[model samples]
Target chain A: MTQVIISPAKANSMYWLGRYTERVYLELHLLRICFDFMIDGKPEEYNRYLASIGNTFLYPDLAAIRSGLVHDKNNPVSVLACVEMANDNAILLRDEIMSPTLGYIQMSLEYLRHAAAESKEPDLDELQKLTDWMLAFWGSIEERVYDERVKNFLRLGKLIEHLDMNIRFSYKFYRIEEAFTSLLKCYDFEPRAFSGDALEDLKKLITEQEYDPRDPVYVNKVLLLLGKVVIL
Target chain B: MQSLIKNRDSVNRWMERYGVRFGVYKNGVFNEQLFPFDSIPRIIEKEDWKVLEKGLIQRVKALNAFLWDIYHDKHIIADGVVPEEFVYASKGYMPECEKVDPTGKVYSHISGIDLVEGKDGRWFILEDNLRIPSGASYPMIAREITRKVSPITFVENHVADNRDYATILKEMMDDMNGGRGINVILTPGRYNSAFFEHSYLAEKTGAVLAFPGDMTVEDDIVWYTGLFNEKIRVGAIYRRISDEYLDPLAFESSSLLGVPNLFQAYKKGTVAVINGFGNGVADDKGIYYFVPKMIRYYLDEEPILHNAPTYLPYFKEDYDYILENISRLVIKDVSEAGGYGVVFGRDLSLEKLSELKELIIHQPRRWIAQEVIDFKDLEILESNEKVERKADLRAFVVSSGKDVKVWKSGLTRFSRNPDSFVVNSSQGGGFKDTWIMD
Candidate 1:
């Protein structure tokens, strides 16, 4: 295995790549639900969908924000926004990721940017394709990325965002377990929690998923094998 | 067609062989990427290029005169042709170049003038890029690959050769050497925007690519250092950095990118620098409006090409009209280029237009408004479908000895977006290989 040494620039890219790819993966699922609801004659519930992510901040009103989120070229936090961020991070880490992986990301972003500019409601199938590409993209990274420093830094970033986004999206059990297990494995030191209250909630979340087939304990063992704490 | 483009993998190999690429910074981070090459060609006829060649020469000669006048005695300003404030206040105008003329009164030995042909087939001068203009290397390499892809295509067509750009540049450097030593291409580093062009040019011309740290000035002579304090005098430098970042002692004091006292060496006649410092005063967008007048004033010949119909908002009448018709024009900041600081009036809301109008009024000198030319579209393939998009051409004019020679083909860049009129490569555009058929 090639030892991946994370330079400062690559660290920044890893952190943002985590922020951006997670943003895209999570939003595509959210937008999929919204699009499905549009077919069911539940237009009123769209505002509830909007409220789940704080419509007032990202949009002007619910309608302006929702449409903008879907297609606005100016919005820095839309689906296109997430892709742009991913593209930018990928561009920065071209040498680290090697050319082929970077080229794929660049190509994918180019497609998404064009799609966003042309269509107000882009084909959901194309969006699905991008998500699948992103997943395959991860596998490719795992294969090509040989340096441990870069791998750990990228994993640390992935875990941080995984924890943050799963909590925000209200993922009940499995996703949260996956996030914590990743967190424990990637970081040597943990950041301060909110008076240990957040830690207590985390412990409860773990206990709640204790006996599930998709078990938290399985994650615990993976973390330990990766030289992380065997947190109960 | 598929077989022709199957050379994409081969083309990538060719790029590796030729070491062709540029560095771009996204979010303050630098990355080098292979500027993708397409096998398609944009062909022009010889008869059409003869006119373009004449106009480009006339334009570059006048620009050279303008740069000399701006740096020396302000002749254009004193003659009341251009405002003195415009000359003095322009960001590209350098005081350090004052009283120092380049060898044989030449400032722009190599000029890249960008032009575009309308649907009616009349070409309009888009802008005059007198500084270190890039993209010439792209077509240089592309021509080679295009021949490999389909050799019979070149045999059937009488294509004017474009491989002499380096020869012309070399002769120009040698002309002004004044018995000094080796000529070099001074680059900021490996991460500059046109690093590929700089390196390729150095390789092609057999000139060393020397960074600032690799050089030192002693007794008004610029000497490049070899390993461990070995030194050799450098005669001519085709530098790829802007003037402000060329020499810290001459322009910006805090510029770490610049070599200190390099301009002093230039002024001492110990070295030659192509497209000399302060040439930007001529390439300034505001200065673009006066090229035809300069041609008439200096060269006494009718300009062979026409500038795009442009309006200077600093003039009261033009300002009022641009304010009123803000929804139809393209307004650009006079000092910015590379597709930055450009606003399409049609894209602005009424309220936003009013706000922009107020800002323009506040600083009229900084703005120029132009009627958007219905720039002709070129066909490109998108998702297996032919799409028409706006594109522009940049012609290279190399001044060697006593002549301004135009390369037969130029780079034709097209906006990938169907509706976008801007085709700057930095703005996510693609290029086509231009061919001048005999």
Candidate 2:
């Protein structure tokens, strides 16, 4: 019956661990889907897709674009960069996470680092393994994290990132609604002003059949609301 | 042993997974590096550990009694067993902690005593670390990962388990909890060099890993504040911060690391502070010279362990001896730790030796010279080849109430540089898990 108080610093790290892990996972998946464009040698489409996700960098070839997506440490959006940040955060919360769980993060990072060092031709098969490890990472979180409150905070950060990614990628309104529904089902957040009320407003818009999903202002407001957390 | 040698990198990888790292700050930037692990372990026969356990327990007990006397009755100093100047002038001596009764009346609840074995099979006490000593987790977790890397080696060898450190630590903390509340491990933050240890021990002990701001002091009581504003009273604090930064109101005015009025709470007798404040007096290099005298004066017994032949320049005879043997002794600055401020006579040029001799003559109290023991060299692997390295053991002994226990394992640190004798982790040394054979 020893006391277990998570310092604010650790809680904040766990929150970001959730955010960065989800961010990298989503970005990696999106790029895997975009690999078809890379294969077709439509570098322009990849450029357009990168711009759509707020990446303004210009690349002449698919290799440069692929490098920016997967390996570039300087590029903040790369899988390697996001995983490194997530791994850093996870390192601080080693007690909160499982040993095998953290091992996955470290091994995945080392594998990516090694791949980057070799600078070989892009191996999509290996890149897909990164995605698989992300799944295992979340699975480990669900299995190993003991404190429900701690887990809830992590899940909340992840849900917020999920909502943000869906919005930025312009997923269909139904898909956004489904993700929002899941967020409401699993997420937990600290109670604050505008969070509860704004959440309800977004729910109202999402559930309403008459609302137009094309309205930018309405979509922005809904995005803001879906960022709020609540257990279903 | 063969399997362990082959699986060294795998164990190191597991250490990285567990974030076995130490942080260092240089040029105002913080950098963290792993405390490299050597697959080879330092092995001690059970008979040797038996002697070590007895000596360590006896030494810690004498040191604890010394702290109590230094603060309360001053019998040791008044009777002239130790000079009052030596005890009062130490940097770690806190005047605010005078006469404060610690939990179970224990001052040094935990002690990490550095020891080395000589070539002639005799052990020498290098130094005593009474204030917030670390490096225990290195050997503890190293044993855990080592077991993974070479299970067959462990299955075959009769090594005593070191994994029980957490349970023993928790029991000590429980005993230290003289009041009604929860135990907390208060750390400065994640930026500390031993932050990994702070968190790891907290997790294992089920103690709260808390920062300065997570808790508040009110009515001379420490409270752990939750996000929902619920407060839990703290019974005992295994505080890892230095005494100067333990309480802003009581020690340093500008320290943000300290909790405001925490010393007030401790003074009010609501919380137990481990290794009690002002204990630096007992571990001071100057005071170290008097430990044998203390063992006799307090315990009325002969010391079971031996200190390396040491000469205090503060005494005229010892000073004369140090001057005569300026080319054959190792001189240490009383103020420095972590392998800093150590000078070997042979390493110094004649000019430097003369300069050091002059400084010692002027400020005799600041220097202590010792005839370096020809310590045994342990074999360590470097680049897949076995090489002999100078290494020393740091043994952690925990005491609470009447119970005292020496942990079965120790951290054996070896100097990575071929020419260096200092084996501090801060000095780029590496460590191996110490196995006290069952």
Specify the highest-TM-score model's number.
Answer: 2
Candidate 1 regions off by >4 Å?
A1-232, B1-9, B16-19
Q: State the number of backbone clashes in model 1.
A: 6
Clashing pairs in 1: A3-A147, A3-A148, A4-A147, A4-A148, A4-A149, A4-A150
Give the Cα-based TM-score of candidate 2 against the true structure: 0.94
Q: Using lDDT as the measure, which candidate wins?
A: 2
Clashes of each: 6, 0
Query: lDDT by residue for model 1 over B337-428, one digit each (tens)?
Result: 99898999999888988888998889988988888887778877665456788889999887754767787888888888787888887777
Which residue segments of model 2 deviate by more than 4 Å? Answer: A1-8, A58-60, A113-122, A186-194, A205-232
RMSD of 2: 2.5
Per-prediction fnat: 0.00, 0.26
